[model samples]
Target: MPLLVTDYSWTQTDSTVYINVPLKGAKVGKVDILSTDEYVKVHFPPYLFEAFLFEPVDDDKSTAKVGNGVVLISLPKRTNKEWDHLMISTNDKEKKKVIRQQALLKYQDKLTSESRSKAEKKHAEKKYALETMMKLEKEERDTIQKMKDTEREKTTAELAAWQLNQKQKAEVETRVKLQRQRSRQTQIKAVTEEQENQCSGEGNVCKSEANCKKKQVVLPAPRLTGNIQVTFTPRVFPTALRESRVQEEEEWLKKQAEARHAVNADTEELKDLKEEHRNPDWLKDKGDKYFATGDYLSAVNAYNLAVRLNRKIPALYSNRAACHLKLGNFHKAIEDSSQALDLLTPPVAANAAARARASVRRGSAFCQLQLYAEGLQDYHAALKIEPHNIALQADIEKIRDIIQGTTADPDTQ
Candidate 1:
């Protein structure tokens, strides 16, 4: 049997009752409290306190606070009257047992109801989040469809205009050709008539015919020929010739051209795209615009198309890696960044910035995946390219601190 708490204090007003029970250094966490209109119980391990009120009090309006080595309970009276005692003076054990069972049952039912309410609230929140995601997906689809339709309309209009212009040009050229033919025929006939009249008037048919024939057979002037200087524009990469590897650049260009031509325009996604939209450069710009606007999914879509059009472009893969990073697709980001780094070869000045960016993006993805050692290597590579970058230096220091177990929060980056 537990020790009974008897040295408790109580005070009352016309409508309220306040009870104070000393905890004897008991922790708040270890205290179990239960209350009802007719009964109250406080259980603390080896000590127990029970109160059976003399008159009914409103449990619904009651409050409890546990602090400073005490448990304080405030109970409101059901009727506007003073309670003569904190507990009822009773000797019947069966009556006390019956009240305690009833209070326990009520408490269990209240707990069940509260738990059900919390579950319903959590379920509602999940449903709302799912619905919001679906709505956003629908909106994105609608926007992409609108863009496709607009591009299709514009391409159609341009094709129609070009066809009409070509037709008009052909008509003009046909008319000019016909006029020149007619003028030449008329001139030949007039010259022939003049020659015949001259032959008849001279009464020397043979001589006149010979003269006319001689004039017609007169040799054309000898063609003037001179040396014609020919010059060819040097085919080279965008970088300065002195600083560039011509062979590698040429090979890179050849690969890019092949990649651009390799796109299967007959595919469902590409078949309906405008000619301009099929260009990797245009798609890259589109992706950049979407990224700037915080539409990472759309940006990824655009970059995907660009990569399909020309897989050799490092910037396309690098930029798409950024979109994947923002979307939290860390693995995909790492893949794209690695591909970009692979394409940014020769380690020249022209590609130094691109290589640095690819390295940093890959490092960020690796760090996000908790591959700190691999991430550190990539960060170091990027820092080498931009040694004076303070932000990059700071990031390197943070990563080092994380690796050394000196960082309080590894997830700070």
Candidate 2:
């Protein structure tokens, strides 16, 4: 007879193979399955599935159960060993069937035979029982050994992970401490340079810290004209005494003007006559370009324009907050980040990343401002959104360290 073709799905465990095949509208009696130690064949009307076993199975223990719209075949392996694959191939179906039948007959005949002596039968039974008990004991020992091995592997993995975490934490703490020390040294160096610049080339050297802080032009109180004090330009003050102060004030004003001008220029460009330039996305991109180039002032300008154009956009505020953070405008950074947070609604999937970034930025600004309590709160909130962010965790630890250090410092309170 010719073999029928069928489509099926199968899965295997340690000792059993399960095959499921579609057999809609077919009765259970119509489904026939033949099993052998080395092969299995299934027949259901127009469909047939056959495969050479990857290993031997106990044919008598195999079963086929049909229900709903499917036929399920369960094959029991003769030994407790695992099969490497489901089957070797789809060949030798006829030859394997003949061999399986002969084996089945021999097994049945052995079961029914009465020619053996009573002594021999008792010995055979006892031998079978002893083998069964040894097999059970071996399986129990194997199970216990496997359980111990798994637990040991688990402990080793956990230890490795803990060691990695500890190493990373130590590195982060060292880096943060070095950064703090460097920042302090830089501040001291800047102050020394400024003092040197103020005192350089002057014939009258400041003899003490009090003199250095005192006004060089210690003029008498200005004369009042009808109860209104007259205000004169720095030029009216003594030239030798006022020159440095006047120049410093002028330079400071000029820098402020340049910064304001740059912002105004960026906003004006974003708001140009071209309609395309007014788009929020275009303005945001422009801001990003400025930020990338380290022009945070101009970036802030662009982001301001973008926010004005689309106040509802959360990203505009978040990006603006980042620029503010870079520019050391902590107050503005906090304000913009708060705006971003307000715009970012709950069920964070919609803008989780944006919300997280905004939180980190706000937290950093708070940390810079010495508001560790608030900064720690923001960091914790950000962590809820990205629990596995190593950098965020490091920041949280740094903030906690700051809090602890501040609490311990006598000067801080």
Candidate 3:
């Protein structure tokens, strides 16, 4: 039998020996095995100062080495407990089934990993396509908007020119009319004065043909007769069309603002949902933030959803209980603290500390329900176990003060 030289232990229940050994470090740095029905040989590389097993049964294979001074020891698999656990009894009692199971599990894991990778690739492709398409769409929209702006600018210039021309034409027509009126007035005044002068020469105006003829002196030149023409100017140019275009542009701007705001809000909502749904801690943080903000109802909702995914938490239940207390739900506070006490198993020191906290919190809840005696007992028990706990000491002092006043009889007063 091989000498058990390593740190290993064996327990004999009846005649069979059960051995538990750690195969780690350089011992497992290399492994090779070959087996027949009666025996198995395990080879190990050197730098392996000591190889551990429950105990190797064959003495001859001990210290056997390859050319590089590595041990090639063989042991009977029947004697190894872990190996035995891995073994299955049948007409062909062998550990082949465990190997097969492990292989199948590994293959399934690989398949699942491959499937996830494919899904991720597909999503990446889709996202890339969506981004590209969005870029193109934005470019197209910008181009169209530019064209519209250009058209609007061109129309505005045309309207301005038309208005300017109309004003100039109006001014010219006014000037011409003024000149004609002045000339006519001047001619009438001259004729009237001349007639008056001629009439005054005889102390009265003569109506006789010979007197009229004497008064009507011959003009130096005969007045030319000409046809007078008139032109009408339009009051406005591109009148109704330009006004309608401007109104349309204003409407389009309003529509664009509304659309952009809606899209931005939707994108923000989507981003929040994605980040929250993927990680549970994010939701918990949000709940804590809400609680900090004094929005107890919103905090309750957020914490409740986070707890649904993972219930193995002490802080979640404790904080939720705090929220319940603030909301005046004493029964809910008791229930949550109770659940927290049941679920949490912290490290020894942490567990002890948490025990005192839970006990004190429950005691407060009990006191709110007027279970004063039980509440006081729980507080005393916590203080006794953790004597130096300052917070507990404070609570105990407050309770003592309350009791000192309450215990005084009315008759004493």
Candidate 4:
């Protein structure tokens, strides 16, 4: 039972009544006030104040203000007359109980209505946000498609122009060749006529024939052949030959080249895929979208296709490992994480984050498999790459506690 508060004061006018209820150091947020035409109540945890109005007032026009550890309420009188007392001079328990019950029911109904309105508003907001996101995505896709179409049209026009130019060039070359052949034939005919006239005029057929034979086209001499030596700048590592790990660099280069051209186009699974679906990067993006939507199986399929298209992409393996982890395929997750780590070798600044992520994922898989030692090693490796990660540090401490038998088994909780 709450203590009844009698230390309240009130003032009245012909048209309004004002009541002030002391909070006794209670927080304003914790104070509850309920007002009606004939009754007013203030509840502050262990303290309660109630007033049965001497005469009915207009509750709709009443207002309450809480400040300075007190609540002040202004009530408008319905009859426009001064009240002799603020509360009714009666102690009828049954009437008080009925009024209290009515007030409680009215408060409960108001709370229910307000909560329903809030829930509806929240739902509407979420729906609008989702619709807006989808619209933006659609617009972006349409823009990309428009760009692709424009590029395709430009390329087609260029190709047609090139083909027409080539055809005209070929025709001109053919005409020039025919004209050269005719000029050579005319020169041969003139030479033959001159030889015949000389023979007839000299009346020496054998001599003339011998002279014509000597005059027959004299060919130029063949040019002397000689070797032309060529040399090229040496292709070597930036570091000195002695200081460089040539073997490792060569292996890395070889792996890079293989990765770039390793698409398995002849596979049965890929034979019926659409052109866009054939792209490894596109598949990876599709996988990411599926993962974001919580469709783990679809995400796995997308990642699987991307991996099959290009096994060298570390991100594909890493993302697939995440999906596997979500699906509770711990062994598969470890395998994918290991593959991602392998592909991210010869660690550089560009891949530092990737390496850390792969290590953490693999470590998680190890821990899930109950291999605490292995997990600890991978976690330590990740920490070395990302020492400033607070979450990672916390996780490491937890794992350590578990390993030392200082905490209960995680599975049990």
Q: Report backbone clashes per prediction.
A: 0, 0, 0, 0
lDDT of each: 0.83, 0.74, 0.59, 0.83
Q: Tell me each candidate's RMSD, in Å, in order.
A: 23.3, 36.9, 23.0, 20.8
lDDT of 3 by residue, 78-163 (tens): 34344432223443334433443343344335445666799899999999999999999999889767867888899899999999
Query: How good is model 1 by TM-score?
Result: 0.47
Clashing pairs in 3: none
- Models ranked on TM-score: 1, 4, 2, 3
> lDDT for model 3, on a 0 to 1 scale?
0.59
For this target, which candidate reaches the highest TM-score against the unseen true structure?
Answer: 1
lDDT for model 1: 0.83
For 94-165, candidate 2 gives per-residue lDDT tens digits of 875665555444433433343345658898999999999999999977976786787789989999999999
Report the alpha-carbon TM-score of model 2 versus the true structure. 0.34
lDDT of 1 by residue, 303-333 (tens): 9988887889999999999999999999999
Which segments of candidate 1 are over 4 A away from where they belong? 188-413
Taking all chains together, the TM-score of candidate 3 against the true structure is 0.30
For candidate 2, the clash count comes to 0
Off by over 4 Å in 4: 12-17, 35-39, 53-63, 74-89, 192-413
